[model samples]
Target: MRIATIGTGSIVDEFLQAVEQVETAECIAMYSRKLETAKELAEKYKIKSIYTSLDEMYQNPDIECIYIASPNSLHFDHAFQALSSGKHVICEKPFTSTVEEAEKLIALAKEKKLFLFDAISNIHLPNFKLIKENLALLGPIRFVQCNYSQYSRKYNQLLNGETPNVFNPAFSGGALLDINIYNLHFVTRLFGSPDDISYTANKHPNGIDTSGVLVMKYPNFISECVGSKDTQGMNFVLIQGENGYLHVKDGANGCRSVFIHTNDQEVNLNAQTSMNRLFYELAEFEGIVQREDYSSCYKLLEHTLEVVRETVKARTDAKIVFAADKR
Candidate 1:
C-alpha cells in the first residue's frame, strides 16, 4: 500500500520504521505543518514527497493510504479529510476525541467505499492472538487487572507550568485516552463491551486526568485497568479465573509474553517475532486493503466504535471533560 503520513511525532517515526519492514507497505509522502520537520522524516525514511499543506498531500494521486498520527483532538479532522478525499485512513488510536467523531468518520469511510482503520496494534499482535486462543483454558473468568503506567516526561513540563499536548484538556489529552485506551482495547476486544463503566481519576487543575483507575463491570467478571502518566507503576495484566489464571507480561500496550497456568500444566508463550508491534497491524491493514475486505474492516471498525463509546462514558463518569466535549 502506498502511503502518506501526517504528523512528525515520535509515533510517526516508529510507524515509518515499521513500514520499512512490511513488504506490502511503503510511505511515499509526508505532511507536516513545518517544512523542516517533514523534510527530516522524509529524508530519514527515503520518502520523496513532502507537503506542508494537507490539501496538497491529499491531492497526490500516488497516495493510496493516509496514515494519521496527529494529536488526539485533530484525529477527527485529519481522518475526515482523508476519507472524504477518497483515500484510505489508518488513524492512530484513541480514534477520535468523542464517540460522535468516530461515528461520523466511519460513516464517511463507508460512504466513500474506503478502508478505515483504527491504528491499534495490540489487538493485531501475535501474542495477543495467542492469549485469545488460550483464554478458554482459564475456564470461568472472575477478574482482570491491567496496569500500563509510565511517568511521562511531559508531566514534568506540566508541573513546570508548561502544558504539553498529552496533559492538555484542550487537545483532548489525558491518561485515559493516551494510555488507558490500550487496556480498554485489550479487554473489550477479547470480551466485548462491559455492562457498566466508571472511572476515578487524579485530575490536574485544568480538569484533565493525569492518572486514573477505570473499572469495567461485566456480567461475571470485573476488569480493572490502571493507567498513569503522573507516576510509574508495575505494568502487566493478570486474568483470574475459577480454574487458573493467565498473566500477560509488559501490560496491554505490549503483550510481550503470556504465562498460562492450569491445574496440571504451566506454559509460557511468546509468538511475536518482532518487537515493533506496529508492524503487525500495518501489515494486516495492508492485506485488508489489498484484498478489498470491507466486511472484515467494518467488523474491526465496529469494535473501534465500541471502545470509543466506553472511553467517552468512562471519562464522563469521572467528570473529566475535554475541550472537544463542548463541541
Candidate 2:
C-alpha cells in the first residue's frame, strides 16, 4: 500500500518510525504546509516526493492512504479530504471537535468504500490487550480509574499571553482534548460509551481548561479519568472488582506491567518494551484496507463517534465549548 502522512512535527517523525516497522505498507510522501519541511522528512525517509498543498498530496497517483497528524482542529478537514479522494485515513485522536463531524466523515468513508480509523495510541498496545485477556482473573468488574497528566511547557507560554494551538480555544485546545482524550479512549475501548458523564475542570485565566477530572458512569461500574496540562501526576490505571483489584502503574498507553491482587494471591505481568503499539495498529490497518472489511470499519467508526459524543458531554458539564460546536 502506498501511504502519505501530513504534518511536520516530532510525533509525525515518531509515527514514520512506527510505520517503517510495518512490512506491507510503503510511505509514498510527506505533506506539510511548508514545502521545505515536508521535503526534509521525505528525504530522511526516502519518500517519493513532498507537497505543500493537501490538494496536490491527495492528487498523487501513488497515494492510497493518509495518516493525519495535524492540529486537533484540522483532523476533520484532512480526513474528509482523504476520504473524498478515495484514500484510507488514519487520524489521530481526538478525532474531531464534535460527534457530528465524526459521523459525517464516517458516512463519507462509507460512501467511498474506504477505511477511516481513529489512530488511538493506547488501544493497540500489547499490554492493553493482555489486560483485556486477564480481566476475568480480577473477578466481576466494579470501578475503574485512569490518570494521564503531564505538565506542558506550552501551558507556561499560554499563561504569559502567548497562545499556541495546544492551549488556544480557537484551535479546540485544552487538557481534556489534548491529553485526557487518551483516558477517554482507554475506557471506551474496554466498556464502550458511558451511561452518563460529569466533569470537574480547572479553567485557566484564558478561558481554557488547563486541567480536569472527568467521571463516566456506567450501569454496573464507574470510571474516573484525569487529564492535565498544567500539572503532572502518577499516570496509572486501577480496576477494582468483587474479588480483587488490578493495578497498572504506567497508565493506559505504553504500559509497563499489570498486577492483580485477589484474595491472598498476587499476579504480575510485564509487557515487552520493543513492542510499539503503532506497529500493530499500522499492520491491522493494512489488513483492513486489503480485505474491504466494511463491518469492522463501521464498528470502529461507531465506537469513535461514541467517544466524541461523550467528550462533548464532558466538556459541556465543565462549561467548555469549541466554537464549531455552536454551529
Candidate 3:
C-alpha cells in the first residue's frame, strides 16, 4: 500500500518506524503545513514527495492511503477529505471529536468503498489478542480496572495560564479523548458496549477534563477506566473473573507484559516482539486493504462507533464540553 502521511508530530516518527517493518506498506509522500517539517520527516523516512497543501497530496493518484495524525479537532475534516478523494484513511484515535463526526466519516468510507481505520495500538497487539483467547480460562469476568495516567509536560503550562492542545477545549483536547480512549477501546473491543456509562472528571478552568474516571456498567461486571494528564503513576489494567485474573503491566496503549493468574498457576504472556507498538495496526491495515475485507473493517468500525457514543455520553453527562460538541 502506497501511503501519504499528514502531520509531522512525534507519533509520525513512531509510525515511520512501524512502516519500515511492514513489507506491504510504504510511505511515498508526506504533508505538513510547514514545508520544513514535511522535509524533515521525508528525509528521515526516505519519502519521495512532500506537500504543504493537502489538496496537492490528495490529487496524487499514486497515494493509495492517507495516514492522518493531525490534531483531535482536525480528524473529521482531514479524514472526510481523504475518503471523499478516494483514498483509504488510517485516522489517529479519538477517531473524531464527536460521535456524529465519526458516523459521518464511517458512512462516507462505506459509500466510497474505501478502507477506514482508527489507528488504535492495543487492539492489534499480540498480548491483547492473547487476553481474548485466555478469557475463557478466567471463567466469568466480574470487574475490570484500567489506569493510564501520565503527567503531561504541557500540564505545567496550563497551570501557568497557558493552554496547550492536549488540555484545550477549543481543540477537543482532554484526558478522556487523549488517553482514556485507549482504555475504552481495550475494554469495549473485548466486552462490547456497556449497559450504562458515566464520567467524573477534574475539570480545567476552561471546561476540559484534565483527569477523569469513566465508569461503565455491564450486565454482570463493572469497568472503571482512569485517565489523567495532570498526574503520573504506574499504568496497568486488571481484569477479574470468577476463576482467575489477567493483568497488563504496560497500560492499554501497549499491552507489553500480560500475566494470567488462577488458584492453580500463574503464566506470563508477552507475545508482541516489536518495540514499535504502531507496527501491528499498520500491518493489519495493509492486510485489510489487500484483501478488500470490508466486512471485517465494518465490524471494527461498529466497535469504534459504540466507543464514540459512550464516550460522548460520558463527557456530556460530566459537563465537559468541547467546541466540536456545539457543532
RMSD of 3: 1.0
Clashes of each: 0, 0, 0
| Span of ten consecutive residues with least summed lDDT in model 3 | 33-42
Off by over 4 Å in 1: none
| Cα TM-score of candidate 3 | 0.98
Per-residue error at 174 for model 3, in Å?
Answer: 0.4
State each model's CA lDDT, in order: 0.94, 0.85, 0.93
Model 2 C-alpha lDDT versus the unseen true structure? 0.85
Ranking by TM-score: 1, 3, 2
Tens-place lDDT per residue, model 3, 1-327, is: 999999999999999999999998899999998888778788988999989889999999999999999989999999999999999999998899898899999999999999999998889999899999999999999999999999999999999999999888989999999999999999999999999999999998899999999999999999999999999978999999999999999788899899999987999998888989999999888898899999989988998899889889999889988889898
Q: lDDT for model 1, on a 0 to 1 scale? A: 0.94
- Residue-by-residue lDDT tens digits, candidate 1, 110-222: 99999999999999999999999999989999999999999999999999999999999999999999999999999999999999999999999989999999999999999
Pairs that collide, model 1: none
Model 2 lDDT tens row, 1-327:
788998888777877888788788889888887777777678788888888888988988789899998988889999999999888899987899988898899989888888899988777777788888888887878899999989999977887889988787777899998889888988889888888999999997667799999999999999999998899789999998898998887787666788888887998887756566677677777788788788877887788898899889998998887776776
Per-model TM-score on C-alpha atoms: 0.98, 0.95, 0.98
Which of candidates 2 and 3 reaches a greater TM-score? 3
- Please say which candidate is ahead in lDDT: 2 or 3: 3
Which residue runs of candidate 2 sit more than 4 Å off their true CA positions? Answer: 271-275
